[model samples]
Target chain A: MSNLKGWKEIPIGGVIDKPATSRLYKTGEWRVSRPVIDREVCINCMQCWLYCPDMSIEGSIEGKRMKLGEFKMEYCKGCGVCAAVCPVNAIVMKPESEFIDE
Target chain B: MPVKLTVTGAHAVAQAMRQINPDVVAAYPITPQTPVVEYYATFVADGMVDTILVPVESEHSAMSAVVGAAAAGARTMTATAANGLALMIEIVYIAASYRLPIIMPLVNRALSGPLNIHCDHSDAMLARDSGWIQFFTENHQEAYDFTIIATKLAEKENVLLPAMVNLDGFITSHGVESFEMLDDEVVKEFVGTWNPKYSLLDTENPVTFGPVDLFDYYFEHHRQQEEAMNNAYEELPKVFEEFAKISGRKYDFLDLYKTDDADYIMVVMNSTASTAKYVVDELREEGKKVGLIKPQVFTPFPKKEFQKALNGRKGVVILDRAMSFGKEAPLYSLIKSALYEVPSRPKLGSYIYGLGGRNTSPKMIRQAFEDAFNDNLVADEQRYLGLRE
Candidate 1:
């Protein structure tokens, strides 16, 4: 947010000074429920990664096997699309306030 | 040597474009404006100009393509009329809001309901609040001259706003007239290369072009646009001064004809002013104290200049080529607002004339002046000239 300037300092077209400030805003606060992934049962189908509206899911290939990477909590609005699209039920939508990190 | 040519307003604009040799021209055709782009397209085909001519499917795409090209740091232009302008109006506002200095030669035509393809100011009037600087031209000479002038004004460093050079459809656009053409080298020197402060292609200075400006910053951006508009009003005379040096033709916010000591004056714009000038001359020979005021620049309204021109006149008649429906005509209401703070103002009368290309002869214009004079210098109500009922 420090990158943001007062209205007077902004250019004529309301151009942003920095590129892609979405990384700085933690949109997770906007969510009432959050998705928790169960890696053990996850088939690595990459369906959740493709279905996430906020593009919070990441996928990678490891030794000829596909695997899910870290979830970007800063941008995840906790939309249940990722959890609902999981064919193997490897993801669950837990209440945001009740979920505690290990 | 300066060349002379007898050509239509559309061809004159094409000749100007050829001399300017813009970076891109993206346009789709509409009636009365097709010849403008058509002529330029031939130049492009013959390798006369190094412009990228984008023949888009629709006016929306035309404007969209130009917006993209202009954001990418290219000097751009386009032409449209009537329904074509209406179709591209959504992007027209975006072009101004983005501060892209695109020059559009807008041929004025009536907005359709009965679907008439004729000359009127309705199309240009509809885009009055769209933030583009508008210059209304009287004839083919002005149509050619203002296009070059508009390019310089739009590209001013402190006043980077889009501009429209408006000429009446069919009347000026199709009518051929003889005018002196500036030397190609002189035109190139007059309108120098466009220098953009920030462009989409500026990788080292990576800045966003258009961003999602919310409630927090949207108002401020608008304030900046307003400031730029004010700057345009100030910067216009300086450009006209420079242009006059080479061209030897003087220009101002409005053209005044024998209004200095006249008692009755008619305020109008575009081709009708030429007809009214004859009426003024005939009335003057009859010893009637009548004059004429023709405004060239429509946007930035030039309130103070108009007030000064209209000062001390006994009766002033304003003619509108387009109607405003439930209220007073557009120019009439605007003139009233311009004179709002003046301590003394001339008695104001308005008439809606030339709707859907109805003929406004010298006789009808003479009657407008006569009506104003016979009304005892009191503006009773608005009237329509040449209306059957």
Candidate 2:
């Protein structure tokens, strides 16, 4: 036990070690294209959640009213499925390279 | 009270399993391994244990069920032999990678095609690189003792890795031998309840299992498995010491019989070591300097110990029941590598013996010793015993 090296102390395996892994892993970086939802037109149908592969869509409810649907960009893989399934043309897939300066 | 029972290796291991009395036993019956699951099934049916005996359809499912049940934080065990292991090999890797402490009792047998189902190490050798602790037992007594030891060792939090307790097919599995059993209550207290660190059933935590990790994280996770393996190797002696306190049988990485001052040494594992020991004893009585080294743990192989033990010997013979096919025998290759750093290392002899369950008599074993004495052995050349020209 005394001779064990620090690298040999890693408790790693296939299971997820952290909670709210979305915050721990910024999966949005994987996106070549990002989904930008136009809140003005979002009907809060939560259609994005219905079609999201990673279920990266979220909407908070307030005062008995559902809020506008927002993309959890940290986890959205930019598959554009949410844009494709939106009932209205409220969500658009934008080139990720355009936002690289920010 | 510890009662001495004359039982076959299969039954002996089952007795240990009954003591460990894991939450799940999901083995598919195969050849020499059948009797282990059979006896365990009887324990389940007679209500001696609270285990859920899952009668899985195939070896693949058997291991899959084990992995799944283990994920749910259940203490799990399974047994298999030969092709059944070959079938379950894929998930066997998954169980280890998941860091599940599943103890499997593997009956050592030849792998198929011209299919023979008797004693050999081919089956155990197949999983050599599978990142699991491996225990090679020489007889029914060892098979029994190591099963208990493997349970506690595998479940250690820092050393959470699966393990295989290997015994030769029919040779140990069917041959009756006398073994003393630790009382169930004592064994129960010794191998205390498993409190898993990662439980799929922990709904409050809600963490992913067997999740996909791309190249970015996969390599790190693999490195962690290596660390866990090292942890097992480092921490194992403590468990062995604890077992010794209750059982009074001190265990070591290698069983070095007459090795300290011998001129010639033979290295073997599992049941073959028994025959090799008999031959060593005979040669010693005849005023010859012969010794035998049987490795108890195959994985995390004791390289330093081998280097020290065989450093100044006259000649060394490594008898492997499994061949590497187009390469030197597996055990031979490992021992040869272990000797590379020692300047005073003995000249090595590689011998492949008892393939597909061929008979390895004491006379056959003596012939290998005779080759070592005459220095008729080349380090690179492979000789055979009990094989026709």
Candidate 3:
């Protein structure tokens, strides 16, 4: 009755449609990969890079700024040697169940 | 009092166990060792020994029962053979680690797998690192003597480690011979009732006996076990001195048989040493300077005593009944390790024989001496003296 939709602040150039925001914005697609990196607690320790039997480490020894060596995902048998030799428990392998295409 | 009768080594062990009157005995009857348990069972059935003899399913269960009974503050005992010992390996480590003071009679036999039932050092060699004090007897008398000594050695409060008295399978376990059995009153006075401030079944004091130890403290527990083993060197003399007073049969780690004024020695263990001593006597009659250094106590191996015995000897030939697959025989390695740093060391030669109960005649043992002396002094073949196959 009293123009309830326009009661809030109205723009001068008619109705401007706003976009919806999502919590999962800008996150990478977690496909079937060998080494999964956690951005929060990753101190960039390269121990996994040193003793990796499959050489399955990715990203640089420094901060997560640049891409360094990538893993040959086909050859990784998931021996957990990288996890064992890790200084900080940052890089963890996602279980095969989590990567199943739903 | 002396019992001059031809009895098997099993009977000898059973008689000693009967006289000692253990509170609990749990044993499994494996071949060459069945006679011991059977004889003891007869004693138990006849009401000779005031004890509970538990008939176990396997050597593993037998050792487990002894450990529990010993933990419950009972004088416990058991016997086993080659494969039986192998099965009880894990619990053997546990029993010694817990310091249960359990005594085990091992009828030394060949470990199987070419399907052999005979005498060999396979069992004793396998258990060299299991933290038990091992004694090897060369004859019926020493076999009887060791059973009594083992009880006294294990029950000492400061040296509460498990002990094993090893007797050769058919040679000692089945062979019949006359020997002296100590008086029951003397043995009773010798092995008094076990009294411990801390025990597993002592309900008055609830304390954890075997707990899960983490790495930080597990090493310390093992170190303590090692300390107890090393403490046996000094404690054994006192225990033996006391035993001497009671039984009047004195013994030492290194039994020097006709070694005085001899320039050469054949070092050995177990029943074969008895035969070698005979050969030494024959050689001495032929004006040879050869003698026998038989180690009565194989574990806590008497390094100083052996060193003194081999001080000025020209050659020291070791006769081993056991064989190491990839390396030298265990006794050979231990002897070499013991004598490596000593000044004026003798020429060392190792001979492997009596495997799977292969007969070792005096002629074969004498051949070992000749082969050792002739084959470039430091021999390495580890020649098998007598074998059917």
Best by DockQ: 1
> How big is the positional error of residue B143 in model 2, measured in Å on the Cα after superposition?
0.3
Better of 1 and 2 by TM-score: 2
Model 2 chain A weakest 10-residue run by lDDT: A1-10
**Candidate 3 segments whose C-alpha is farther than 4 A from its true place:** A1-102, B379-381, B387-389
| Tens digits of per-residue lDDT for model 2, B1-389 | 89999989999999999999999999888999999999999999999999999999999999999999999999999999999999999999999998999999999989997799888889888999898899999998899999999999999988899999999999999999999999999999999999999888898877667887664566767888888888888987898899999999999999999987899999999988888898889999999988999999998788888998999889999999999999989899999998888989798899989999898999999999999899898998999998999
lDDT, candidate 3, B309-352, per-residue tens: 78667787888888889898988888877877788887788888
lDDT of 3 by residue, A1-102 (tens): 122233123211111222232221222222344566565665555667778765555556445444436654545666667767667786687675665443
Model 3 chain B lDDT-worst window of ten: B211-220
Candidate 1 on B261-352: residue-level lDDT in tens? 89889988999999999999999999999999999999989999988888767789999998888888889899988887877788998888
Clashes of 1: 0
All models, DockQ values?
Answer: 0.33, 0.27, 0.01
Task: Give the per-prediction TM-score of chain B.
Answer: 0.98, 0.99, 0.96
Model 1 segments more than 4 A misplaced: A1-7, A23-102, B376-380
Model 2 spans with C-alpha error above 4 angstroms: A1-11, A27-102
Q: Could you estimate the TM-score for every candidate? A: 0.84, 0.85, 0.78
